[model samples]
Target: MREDTFCWGIVGTGRIATIFAEDIQQEPGMEVTAVVSRSRDRGHAFAQSQRLRATVTDSINALTSSGNIDAIYIATPHSDHLPATMAALQSEYPVLCEKPMGLNVAQVTALADLAQKRGVFLMEAMWSRFLPAMNAFMTLLRQGAIGEPRALFADFGIDVPLAPDSRLFNPALGGGALLDVGVYTIALAHKALGRPTNVYGRARWTETGVDGHSAYTLAYGSGAVAQLFGALELNTPQQAVLCGTQGRLTLQAPFFRPECVSLTRNNGETNHQYHPVTGNGYGHEAREVADMVRRGRKEHPTMPLAESVAIAATMDELRTQWALQYPDEP
Candidate 1:
């Protein structure tokens, strides 16, 4: 490990954690030097699977307090996000908590306050924001290349296997299509068209009481509207469209990490493609976290602490509309 490198203690052994470990090792200036799992065997197994030459611990304290660790990446279940993040914050370590940072807005706000008091870097790992194509897409929207963006449409739905114990359907684990994949649609739409003034939504609930499918609309004060939806039982096209007065932009399927964008101008059939990223794209966010910490910044400008809470707030309202609540949420 280079002396100037930032070392991350990964606090989860799930799929997300695995992807993070695989990607981070490929990047320079940062490394995942430790892992925290629920059980010793899980921790060891994860470390072995990742082929990491680092310490593996089952306790958050052991990993968070390590002198060699520079930050903590909370990739645990949604229900574990708060306690894991709080522990890392209390230990004076900056954190990159995965999206849906908490169960609800209140939980997210508490974390923001804690991180502020601790004066450490805290960011919701909404990785899409940092993708090169996303930045370019934002620039195009900002530059008025598409004229006035009046409406947006986005969706993220995967046909997940219905296993009650799986995080995608487990209420106790803070699972559902909304938190698991819907946040991406919300985050992207909200970024392109500021916060909405009103949110209307409906959903189909699983027998386990979690949201199985949901559709929602966000109305902005500027007359911009966003129609976004997510589902756990069906697979939609997973694309996103931004329509403006002069032209339109469409991020193809898998919009979250899209590699191609389509721009149509002046109602003509003329189409243009913009491709602007390489690799799995998780490195962009990790790179941002490293840069922010290096500059002693408490939060990233693109994905601030406030935006994280606000997005969760919208999800909270949508859940209310559906009358769905996780058993573990207070």
Candidate 2:
């Protein structure tokens, strides 16, 4: 663990991978040193475009065993995260995998256990948890700015075109509205409130048997409930609302990357808070991973391993209720 700069290797060249790679370049103590893609040409092209010296390789074995990369970021499809993380773990490399950590709870538990036993750092890329505004919102909640939170309403849905062959509709790729976007809504609910005691969900499945729309309700022990919805067939407001005894907080578009929030008091007075991010919000998560590695920590304090497991478990339960089984799930 060096104090100066941490070397990173990207495991995929997808859209998310490109965004993260660009964000890494902006950070001071982080650099993307390598990229692994199934196509060597694509890997080389992505690396060159980023202006980084990369060892392009089509083989995961070669990329992991090169002994030149510090941590590997898994940006592959949801179904591929497990295998990719395992490949890196086998080579004694730490991993920061994209969320929903695995296709199911059992797989997530297995991978988390393996990483722990191997004494390697493993983190889920739930970028929302590392954002500045989210941190401030949590702080405000803790300080009783919103009083005792009673309910949370959040929705994240996009107008994804219906294509049976696309990953969004392919059951084999762990495609669905829940795993694709609902994970963020669930995470937000969990962050604001603890794990729910009762969970119920209703979903509309696509022709290929994948969920295109899902609405879930989670009941906590304190009689608080979280209402969340995710859909690929519709364009939702993509907002988040936290209601408490004294006031309510509302976030604008893209609740996951919210830049502004409004708090309404019991007296009907509203106060708006704005946080301007320095670079793309992705850099915050990258800096967090770098700092964690520098401090010799295996998991982030904000996004703990336990939280990842719990979120997976919740998603697993919802999928089971909706009969949404992916090809990767055993």
Candidate 3:
């Protein structure tokens, strides 16, 4: 809350939380002031490794009660985002939660409404939308570089060893391929095609009663369709393609962390490569949140709350189609 810097409180000590802590340490105007984890030893170790002056605690109430943090970053699992975010909002601290934002659309809407009522800034940590390359790509699309994006194909999948109780395969933990990795593809599709009129999905479920692989086809009223695939049992190409009447755009490997894009037009093929980002590409989102809070904004202009709701709705519909229900859903 200081004029020159923002003090951040991290709400989890998981893998992603560690990455975000490191990234925050690298930024000039930000500091990790506290870290909350169920394991006191892990929280203390994380704080020590980052050389951060932090109040490490296992309870959410204890972490938020310090009344010293300017903002909180929710790095817990998708199922835990809602409760953790609510805790931060109740404490009058703005929140930046990692995507897909929630286990379902209702959770996202409730959080957005709560943040609004509390007059606190809330942003979903959809880091891809904050990347420089994605920003440029959106600009090009708006400028008719691709002549009205007509179709999009995106895939994100990985081969993970099957452990029934692991979060990735556990139904009680909101585990599935769609929530795990397909959310990225769905977000991109929604970005290019808007909300779909209809969604069709097919999945291969694991023995542990969770989806191991899945495919989705979304039909838009504009006569465009997006084909998306995600899996935990296979290693996919994990690329994104946007095709229009005039040209096509291809994002290289790791579409979410894309650093290069190729555009093919009637004139010729052009390749654009973005500068390598510092601090594992998470600094972009951190800086974005800081800028928004500094300007007294409630949400980001690029990735608004409505977009988050629509993306969650799409996932909800996809889940309905595949008959895949997370324990958290109802």
Best by lDDT: 1
Best by TM-score: 1
A best-first ranking of the candidates according to their lDDT comes to 1, 2, 3
Looking at model 2, report the run of 10 residues with the lowest lDDT sum.
321-330
**Residue by residue across 1-330, what tens digits does model 2's lDDT show?**
345678899988988899899898888878888899999889988888888877888867898777677789999998898889888877778889999888888878878988888888899999988888888789888989888999999999999889988877889988999989999999999899989898989999889888899999989999999999999988999999999998998876789998888889999999888986656688888888888877888889888888889989899899888777776466
Candidate 2 achieves a global lDDT of 0.87
Candidate 1: segments with Cα more than 4 A from true spot: 269-271
Worst 10 contiguous positions by lDDT, candidate 1: 270-279
TM-scores, all models, native as reference: 0.97, 0.96, 0.96
Give each model's clash number: 0, 0, 0
Off by over 4 Å in 2: 1-3
Q: Positional deviation of 100 in candidate 2, in angstroms?
A: 0.7
> By lDDT, is 2 or 3 better?
2
